[model samples]
Target chain A: MPTEPLAKRPGGRSARVQAAVYQALTDLAGERDVTRLTIPAVAERAGVNPTTIYRRWGTLQALLAEVAVARGTDAPPSSSGDLRTDLEAYAVRTLADLTRPGGIAFFRAEVSPDIDERRSGLRECLQRATAGLDMVLEASRGRGETPPPAERLLDQIVAPLYFRVVFSVPDTDEAYARALVADLFSGTWHSAVELH
Target chain B: MPTEPLAKRPGGRSARVQAAVYQALTDLAGERDVTRLTIPAVAERAGVNPTTIYRRWGTLQALLAEVAVARGTDAPPSSSGDLRTDLEAYAVRTLADLTRPGGIAFFRAEVSPDIDERRSGLRECLQRATAGLDMVLEASRGRGETPPPAERLLDQIVAPLYFRVVFSVPDTDEAYARALVADLFSGTWHSAVELH
Candidate 1:
């Protein structure tokens, strides 16, 4: 028996509009604060009708949410069965994205808003990224590298990279990332249980 | 020997203006975005002449920078011989400050501005915090309770707490903080020198 090919969900006009909006957001990010980016400006820049942009996104904050989620979806997973290598790869990939022309600016915009809806979107993105890291750690343990608790992994390894990035400081380098992995795994590697 | 009170500096008027500006900034932070905050508004709220604020600080960014530095000066040092206890106390204190009314909002404003001068103030504050943490870690090592690599202490122990607080997430409780201490001490405490 032959297996069925995965069918693409029909996004149609909405998908095209989303792509255009994301492009506009990225473009605006290079020059100014994303919060100051108006829907009409984005529509004009993307060559879409302003009415269509508003009809679809409802608000600039809503459009920004979709764009933020889409940006994160593009990151490929890293699991090489080595925790140190995997984490370093994760850090490097994250650092590269954050240091890109629009990345840090986008992050700043996400958190700057005092509104709950906008803040929630940013929080959700953070939660997803953290969950992804948890999976990486789980995979490491499955391969016989019993690591410390998830909270610890988050605290010691993942959090600093972000602190440096969002706060606009030096990137947490390859050496620092690797040292984090080694420190976590030292003798405790034998005790780490694969997370279900 | 009893020392006489320090002589007042000739720049007392400038100092008073700076203090008043900071007071107005803090008060406005409770209700408005620091980005949109203006000199005339600050002077009126602070009960000082607009010319005084401008003449003393030169610009809004300069005044805000001074305020940021002043806010950071009161953070307690973290050395108490015991890394776990000291770090936990520090985390709790930092979290208390971050969650206080106008605290996180004030931080967001200073750090989120796209201008380099505004961001430099935040960077300096972070540097000071990092330096203080480094001192605490060094003290822990001197006690033979901490293992070698310095970066591990940063990545594993301190980084996560800072991340959670800055992101406005839930606090890392004492139990989790203690586990982090145990993980670092057991695993990478001795690995720092080896890496070098």
Candidate 2:
């Protein structure tokens, strides 16, 4: 049997508006200093009403955060029932995405400190990403398997990948990503006194 | 006596010029967008010849990297005899520096990918920082102590702290920094088959 429509159809008007806005914002970011980018500018470029943009995104930083997440980080691997398999796939996919052309920029934007104050758009992005991982973890819990904490997965697996990229450290390949996941499951890192 | 003139007084003319340039660069960075910041502008602001900056830093990115390092990361903990103590102290110092007012901005500039393409000034800064750690590790090795690899220390201790900050994961305080050091020496993480 065919898959369930390959996820929900984004043919709705809202989706179209989102695409247009994202495209306009990206074009504007490329053309000018992002510090000066405004919601009205993005709305104008996208041909969307400023009120619609304001009502939906509330702030320019949130829109940037959403775009960054959508561009690189939102596409986690489909769950495979086994937590290890799921996590490894996710780690590998994250690694691949980060190393792809312009992927680092998207990742950098997702964590950029400039956009973090007041509204905390990046934090929202992180929470949404964490929620996705939590679903996989919850499924493992339901199956009576002791999955590692989602935070641990992030600390051990996700953090290192971004660290290596941001710091320009070498050897952040698929092998390294797989090794991080392996270390998490090997129970080595968890053997300590569990200091949270 | 008097801490050896506070670790060698920077009274030389070259040192004076260095300070002026760094100050000027900082002032300029504050006044203008960093992307548009140039060496000539900094030189003019400092009342120094443009060739002086070109000869000393070679590039604007290198100068920025130096400023970032000098501003926060360069002052690692003075190496005590014990490796654990040194690493913990260094980690704690780094945590404090990153959390200080305007500290995270310096760090962001240090790892900012925008300045990373050509001269790799940030990499040089990283090497300098790593070298300081290596001195501590080397002293331990000289005392017949088995020191962990420098890269592992960076990945485990340093990477996690910066990751927590950059990603806005909360609770990256002194206690967390100390715990990370504790984890490193606990022999738990290293128990796994060394992938590297």
Candidate 3:
């Protein structure tokens, strides 16, 4: 069966431009290998000016990284009173975003020190990646628990979900998220804090 | 400074072929992106025949996957009776392997459903990826403690390490690995098992 070109509902003109560009980028990834992707082709498909893309993004890697940040993390953190549910929401959103059609490819490209030499706004993704964890950590503190260091929280909870997300290792689900968060809070949390 | 071509110490003929092929592959990845890699290009650089590559591996994806597995998994599991010590060794080795110059690129290329359509021998990497957790699980059973499911062990300990490895987010070290294993056994195991 022939595949259809990706199109989204019209929104603010700027949003529409970004969507068109990202959709075009992913569509090209579908037609051929992403390593062959060029900004001209993306602009052609996106129906935006190639010069504008160069002015805005400067490089294909930067464009992909921006698309990834836009499509993958548009949702705000869920603030369920229960920490487990909130954490699970973050996991589900992250997994869904990254594992989506073009999500993993973009981030994979973003992290490659070689392919992405510009090294532009990528640190913002790092911060965004942990924003949810920061929320989860705050909740832990509110529960009167001495939360493990941000480093530990990231390693224990956020890292695993992303590892699974990128590698397609374990199933990412609420159950999986809950089990991990619960384990962190169990006696492990206290001992881990002491280790720091 | 101009980069030098990747060369290896003289070895047996089989090792020579493997080294030549991997060096050619990474060199091409250096010259052009990996998605543009072809057996012909690899053959040209390696001074090996295209027919030989086709007969042996059948595709560029398989060849890259093999390179990743070979380069990345050369170290065997360190068997320390103490789970934390053992886990630390495993984590350190894994982070070192994947984050090395060519290692992450290979796996990132290896896992893509499109690039790796053959999906041949990729599971070995997955198995090797989890081998440490497997040993830890067995040790738990030996201690008469019901180990948390493989899923949990991965998410809690292994995932975080890989997450850091891939994204350069949280740092991976013996100290980080030890904290994770210690947390797993402290009191979380009992609760997680009961929940299961």
Candidate 4:
């Protein structure tokens, strides 16, 4: 049997429900497209009341959006001393993560504008997703290195990968990531303050 | 009366049905969350049989995916032959289009993985989206402008704006567009090819 997710959490009915629901979503998401996921199915798998999920999550998109948020951004590779190597590894890991079972569904589901207003947690989810990368920037800033501005980083590094992610075209391999870093380094981007 | 999309296309009962269905979807998508859109709702809106929609479009996602592709990439601004100004204008226009009523919905609908398997049309949609940018690249190549590699362009320019589009953060104004173009110009990305 697959490892049980809920068992790892603290003992409590509410906690159990969350663990089960998250686990069920994680498993089901891997096996099938997220569109096929319904609250009743999640309820059945989680052994919780469908009404509970309906009441808590309100909608399938809402439930799935939370599940995606719960998945969190797996931390990027442990940083080596070198910024370039670390950042490149970060980009590659991000691409690799998308191929993981629930990763694509999470992003694909998150991208929909329909869920935007309903899934109010989007900002939190993104903050969590970028938390790891932000740390890298913070570390560079601490070292007295002027890390690239967030806007420049978005344009040069994050956007290309996202564009590839959404389109599922053109490779986003190590070379691509390095090239992006190189492009940003080559240019004098707009001046930006360090992340506070 | 709502504007009809396929009015300019060739005529036929089948074509008329396609036009009506497409028009209905386009119109409905503007007012409501696409997740709430059901085939029956679309069928009633389009004045076509729901079964016909099921037979022809298969799933709501499948139908929506095509509608998105059908909505297509808007052509970029007319060029003034100055590469930097033209490209910046293109970027600004792309951002402006996203703010339009249905633009975000179409993209949100387009990115789902369920439809990825069905809509091989996604690639064509993207190609159409980039056709204008590609022309700029080709023109530069013709002018012996070394112009950064496609990967570089994707990372530095395309990715940044798209990041904003998906995340809906950090303004992507005309000023930002000009800055990105300026940054690219400042870089020694790739080797020597004179911009004519």
Candidate 5:
């Protein structure tokens, strides 16, 4: 396995240590459950001392949170103008990533612990990924193609795909994705406006 | 707090111990995070010896898994003649349970390392809940209110609510419940079939 350095920045020794520790975590996640991972083993994989990792992340949970956020940041954003096409693309991509050899394994490790900080990171990543759907809804509203309450449209459309992913299940198919988009565009979304 | 006894038979010593342990867990969840709860504390709360708890449940994680399964088994079946109404009722009830004072706290506690068995219990509970919805869809098909491929209806109607519950910040308003039902029943759902 190639242990590439994390981020190339002109920082001090501490930055280097942080990068090495995160790489070690990724390596461990690929191999086994994060719950079974230990600080000593992480240090050995990173080729650093355990003390350095402790000083940097303070706790194993903290380390995992950082790694999760870093991994999320690396994913590219979706910006297709068409709502149905964009969402279908997003769902397919997300499903592909989650079902990959180590993908669900990594998410299972991170999500099993409902730590507030980690949950916050996961939520943020989701919001970032789905932000485009919100934009599409707004544009559709401008065109009088759909109703207002952009958040509901986005939520109804995008939330289920992630739900399936988190539960380690099959991906939502293209037909289902298109159906969700049709639902969002239909006037029925207006009925739930009171809920918001 | 009223400590509801779990098992009715209460003949076997092990069954009694399990019931007591579950009750203790419910009480603890009412007060604090379940992840931080210790074996001695649980034993004290249940008025049993710590050794007895260890002997029966093996570990805090195992005890938690058993408790989760017990709690999950109580989820009501989806019923009421109308598919939309049945699903709305189910969603409202689930939301109430999930957001109740001790509900989310208990859920977060059960999420932890080496707890796949506990998570699986949750999935099983979800499957049961969804199965109830499936029955509704099947009935709808009998009336010619919906198309074939029961799984599609299941995915469209049920998946989003669960997605909101597990992924998004939950919104349990009656209006939201109504809208969810309306959206599913609208022509948009039928449109998917035509498109397919």
Candidate 6:
């Protein structure tokens, strides 16, 4: 029988440290305001030296961006092969995730001054976040249906969700999400604009 | 001849002090990072004592919010009685204003931590920002044409502009703003989505 030390194996010391640190930062973030969070506090909670976190992430904003990217890049909703079905489900889930605990912090972290440079962390995060919609659009095209540019989806659907959340708009419910999708597929943005 | 002192006239000393402070803050904001701004710096530039600023505005965030509200409440674009023409002009102006020097700072100030509470500074800013859109919609209704809800215009027209600004999306040009208004009025969000 061959035995490998836990520290020397494939899913070993480095991976464990990263997971622990991510968990610690998320837990701390949930417990207090994100503005007051610090490396030492996360290090203590993760039971690792603060220098390790500093060496790996370089800065707290980078760490937060890493966490946000991880969360956003999680497996996108499996496409049901129907465009409307996929879009409605995606929209509903996106709204739910944004309103979750520490969600706004994650969003702010992604767009914070230090990470929002075009060719860096923000770009990667945005790409990952849009992967699901791209997949859906591609599948619709394969089915011989013309799909809107991914930019249009971003403009009409995703933009409104974030806007309502950021601006504290009161009507950002599931029904509103459905209405947007409905209005999109219905060939009319609003009945009032039909007069034009 | 009227011999009233400037201090005793209608738009007198108090108003002058406020105008000076607003100008000083905007100039400073354009020249430096907003995170580093301080009341003493604003007071010095405005030629007023720091205590007077503190007493009048309560906090730097309050001063920033006041400046934003004043800028946003400026006369809305005159309605041209043509919905498409009016919307296109408004959208173009909105995008241009947001991209101006110190403009993003004004937006940040309106949505910053201490000012975002409902029924507060944010509410007033939003109301003032949307005033022109509401007027256009009302005129359309009066012309025996159905107009979309003000919120729809907000969702379709306003949200995307701000989202692009905040996220640093690169395609936020005059043509993009014009396209958004065109698509909204055309009732075809995109040539692709029409297949559904």
User: What TM-score would each prediction reach against the true structure?
Assistant: 0.73, 0.70, 0.73, 0.81, 0.75, 0.79
Model 1 chain A: worst 10 consecutive residues (lDDT sum):
A1-10
Better of 1 and 2 by TM-score: 1
Regions of candidate 3 where Cα sits further than 4 Å from its true position: A1-19, A26-41, A48-58, A113-122, A139-146, A193-196, B1-16, B23-60, B78-84, B113-122, B135-146, B190-196
lDDT, residue A23, model 2: 91
Name the weakest run of 10 consecutive residues (lDDT summed) in model 2 chain A.
Answer: A1-10
lDDT scores of the candidates, listed in order: 0.64, 0.68, 0.65, 0.67, 0.59, 0.74
Decreasing lDDT order of the candidates: 6, 2, 4, 3, 1, 5
| Model 3: DockQ vs. true structure | 0.33
Better-scoring candidate (lDDT), 4 or 6: 6
Score candidate 3 by lDDT.
0.65
Candidate that scores best on DockQ: 4
> How would the docking of model 4 be graded?
acceptable
**Please, what are the lDDT tens digits per residue for candidate 2 over residues B1-196?**
0111124555787777888988987776654234346889889989999998897677675677667656754474566788888888878876765665544445545545553341264576567657767888898998898787787777777778877876667787888889888866664555564756
lDDT of 6 by residue, A27-58 (tens): 87665345457899999999999999898787
Candidate ranking under DockQ, highest first, comes to 4, 3, 5, 1, 6, 2
Chain B alone, model 3: TM-score? 0.68
Q: On a 0 to 1 TM-score scale, where does candidate 3 land against the true structure?
A: 0.73
Q: Decide which is better by lDDT, 2 or 4.
A: 2
> Model 4 off-target regions past 4 Å?
A1-13, A47-49, A73-82, A112-119, A190-196, B1-17, B47-52, B73-79, B115-119
Model 2, stretches more than 4 Å misplaced?
A1-63, A72-76, A111-119, A187-196, B1-63, B72-76, B113-119
DockQ-based CAPRI category assigned to the predicted complex of candidate 3 = acceptable
**Best by lDDT, which number?**
6
Q: What is the TM-score of chain A alone in each candidate?
A: 0.76, 0.63, 0.73, 0.75, 0.67, 0.82
At residue B167, give the lDDT of candidate 2. 62
lDDT of 6 at A110: 56
Q: Quote the chain B TM-score of every prediction.
A: 0.69, 0.66, 0.68, 0.78, 0.69, 0.83
Q: Write candidate 5's Cα lDDT for B1-196 as tens digits.
A: 3233434554577667767777887787665333456789888988889998888678776676566656666766645666566667765665655555456444444443444743675566557556666666676666556543545544554555545554545464556656665666563555654321
**Per-residue alpha-carbon lDDT of candidate 4 for residues A1-196, written as tens digits (9 for 90 to 100):** 1222334545687777888888988887776566667788888998989998887777766677767665554453575766666677766666666656766667756665464553444565556647667777777777777777554565566667777766767665667767777655554543332222
Clashes of each: 6, 0, 0, 2, 0, 0
Model 3 chain A lDDT-worst window of ten = A1-10
User: Comparing 1 and 2 by lDDT, which wins?
Assistant: 2
